[model samples]
Target: MFQRPGKNEYLESQERYVSLVPAEGDLLTILKEQTAEMHSLLGGLTEEQGNYRYAPEKWSIKGVIGHLTDNDRIMSYRMLCFARGEQAPLPGYDENDYAAAGEFDRFTLKEMVEHYGIVRQSTLALMASFKEDAWTGRENSMTRK
Candidate 1:
């Protein structure tokens, strides 16, 4: 089981997100369980429900799922780069831009969730492939000018 990362292991800006993870637990198992939980929770929503937005400016349920899927892919890629000891400067991304580009409303929620499942499966596979030492490897040159 991978231990929770130290505060210093990630950027201060990411603390809010990092702290959401429980301090103790098998990370992989939690990830798998979370996937099932998401599927259970979102699987029942109708396509119309998925298209609903709280406000005109807010993303629909489908957009939210698409954004999460995109975030997962990006985060997993960063992890992969870290595990491989890559030193290239990693650029940041704007979630708003991604969400706008996705045009998530065109697809059904089931399609979006299924795509998420595929991405999560790949993420699980990548995490499982990492050696013990790879967990400690990180790209420290991510700072931007």
Candidate 2:
């Protein structure tokens, strides 16, 4: 028989696996800085370099960036649902499916990076406008155990 996770196990799992909830005042700033850093790192790559995968089955650099953008969108939506006090539990997503569907390998690195920046900006704006209570409010995440 399978045993339920104990309190300690549950807490540890959360710390090890769950995404950190940002404090409202710092959320936008943090996201902006992170987005800038990501762009800077990826900005100089050539198309061939961006499309090169580490292994045959691995994702290319562009694919990884695309995946990040997809996750950002999904998380932002989940945050909106939580802030709005939606009662239903949000659904999980398969990153592989999303990344495959995104066709990142076909995109130029610059384009993928710009797309990520745009999504990050939109997420920052959404977080900036959230009410004070919404910042502190808790909601069950489908991606979290």
Candidate 3:
């Protein structure tokens, strides 16, 4: 059986788990800045670098970017669920499985980066529109709990 965390446990866990929960006044700005940074880091890679894996069995840079895109989408969905007060436990994903299936080694770094930028922009727009109440809301996300 699953048990809800006690108040102290919840608070303690939240301190370590929540990511990018902006201050009351700077939510939009923070989201914009973060999105821009993601764009900048992802935009400077070349095709060879994207396909180059650090290890034979590890993900290529393009795969890493794809994984980040997937994570952003998942977090956006979780935020939406939290904002609407959903109690259903969201499912977790296998990162390695997803990365393996992505076959990002075939794509050029420039293409992957462009795709990441578009996804990040959409995520930023969604986050920027959330009201204060929504931004501060909590949910039992797989990533956080």
TM-score for candidate 3: 0.73
Candidates, ranked, lDDT: 1, 2, 3
Candidate 1 pairs with clashing backbones = none
lDDT of 3 by residue, 12-115 (tens): 53554443353233545666687788778767766776677889888888888889888878878876776677777777788888777777667778777777
Model 1 ranges off by over 4 Å? 138-145
Show the lowest summed lDDT stretch of 10 residues, model 3. Answer: 1-10
* Number of the top TM-score candidate: 1
Error of 3 at 110 (Å): 1.6
Alpha-carbon lDDT, every model = 0.86, 0.75, 0.68
CA error at residue 98 for candidate 3, angstroms: 1.2
Which candidate, 2 or 3, has the higher TM-score? 2
Model 3 residue 25 lDDT score: 38
Preferred candidate (lDDT higher): 2 or 3 = 2
TM-score of 2: 0.80
Residue 72 local lDDT, model 3: 79
In candidate 3, residue 142 scores what lDDT? 34
